[model samples]
Target: MKMALSIALLVVMTSSAGAQYLGNYSANPYAPNSTGNAYGAGSPYNPNSVNNPYGRYGSTHSNSSANNPYAMDAPKLYDSQGNYRGRLSSNPYDPDSISNPYGRYGSRFSPDSVNNPFGAGNPYVPDSPTNPYGQGFSIQGADDD
Candidate 1:
């Protein structure tokens, strides 16, 4: 009897581990991180939100999906029913998320990412044509202290 109990407990725990990710867009649907509230600064679907320990599955029409400007260039993925599954890598809760494989919403995955921080509008990029302060800095309030 003890062995049977241990086996059952192990099965449950193991299944939950694979479901560590969170979001409606997750490939796995065992335990969806479902929420009626809109995704944003403090909602479940918000990729920037943390501590989501379950499966993910976001819809394309979700508030966060429609509002976040970052999704403009990011790739989009969908489910069988085609219900706006979610952006390619927009979930921040799942570290191993297929959508967010590198996690951090791909914070360092692309040229525009903070890790690289260089592109059309990066002010720090001296060679970028859109850099407003490329080679010059006036230090507007340096002496405010």
Candidate 2:
């Protein structure tokens, strides 16, 4: 009985740890690892998908949308080691978005911007999502939840 309990505990712990990172695929449509199918993460039909223009997280009018420049809360990027990087937004007008070419964290000339080939955007950087040839990083949801 003790051995069985220990095995169960180990399984639970391992699953919990795995949940913290996005896998190659996930059941949660909001997860970055989800497929882009109709009910998947990047699906335009998925109500919770960031690709859904009318969804809460994707609507241009929504306060939490990545398309909203004034959005106070956007999905965050993190290194494989779980270090907070910056907001993962496509809004070029958003000051905190990596897509903003003039923003401090988004500028191609900035060391922190992913557009900087020699910096965080380097494809050789193990923690960079732009590093398609490397291990890559994680895209975590907003902490405000």
Candidate 3:
């Protein structure tokens, strides 16, 4: 009975230890060995990888609430430094916002930065007669006799 009791205690302690993490940490900065705690946020892209397009970690707000590319409907806005800016509806991606210098898009690509004053959703537009609104609907003028 004594042996069984000790073994059970040991198992319980180890299990709990594995699920524990160091204190004094927030989900803002992510850590490789810092799991079990929901306090760390992952870098927008693999900061360690050479192919990683995101700028230097912690330099461009990697912990931003709007930079969740892992989410179901993540936006594709990246800054000049290649850091994730934010979504179109978000401030960082909005031309009206003081933070958005490149306009709607986070990058310099014309297609992503163009602002559509006459549309909704994503104001970034081609504005051509063939396809003025990328995803937004269009309006027709009344016919005259």
Candidate 4:
């Protein structure tokens, strides 16, 4: 009985030690150990390869004013650094008659054409064809007409 107890304790201790090292026993079967193109850890593409177009990563918007390819004077609002703000409809009071009504840094892009004469939601265009003014339907030659 004493011998059997000692053997059992030794087996339990040895099994516990082996179980502790189970995680480190083998290389990860899920992860490939060696490949033809070994470029360190989580590299999807060949790091040393020259033609890795998708692998390139860097900030391109550093010098916007200089590197800007499509930099042109838009008919809408803009800022000092040539950034769009809002459309011409952003500002209601001051009219950007000749120049852009909205500031340069405007997000919207509404041309100061026949769209919004008075404001965005309302244009003072005549409802009727003969009525050059915006009035409701009336008689041919009525007094209110």
The candidate that achieves the highest lDDT relative to the unseen native structure: 2
What ranking emerges by lDDT with the best candidate at the front? 2, 1, 3, 4
> Where is model 4 more than 4 Å wrong at Cα?
19-145
Candidate 4 lDDT over 7-117, as tens digits, reads: 999998766553110011011223221111124211236331111224211012221111122222112322223333232222232243212235222113443232333
Per-candidate TM equals 0.24, 0.61, 0.18, 0.15
Q: Considering summed lDDT, which 10 consecutive residues are worst modelled in model 1?
A: 136-145
Summarize candidate 1's per-residue lDDT along 35-123 as a digit string, tens digits.
22233222544543321222122333333232223333223332323332224434454442224435432344544232223422244
lDDT score for candidate 4 against the true structure: 0.25
Q: Write the per-residue lDDT of candidate 3 for residues 1-145, one digit (tens) a residue.
A: 9999999999987666531111111111233312112332232343321112362221223322122232222223333233333342234544422235566443334333323233222334332111323222111111111
For candidate 4, what's the RMSD? 32.8
**Model 2 clashing residue pairs (backbone):** none
C-alpha lDDT (0 to 100) for residue 140 of candidate 3: 14
lDDT of 1 at 56: 22
Q: All models: lDDT?
A: 0.32, 0.62, 0.30, 0.25
Candidate 2, superposed: residue stretches over 4 Å from native = 1-40, 91-95, 133-136, 143-145
Stretches > 4 Å off in candidate 3: 1-64, 67-86, 89-99, 103-109, 117-145
Ranking by TM-score: 2, 1, 3, 4
Tell me the TM-score of model 4: 0.15
Alpha-carbon lDDT of model 3: 0.30
lDDT of 2 by residue, 38-136 (tens): 444567776656667997767888876666777766666666676655666777777868788998658999887777888777767655656543444
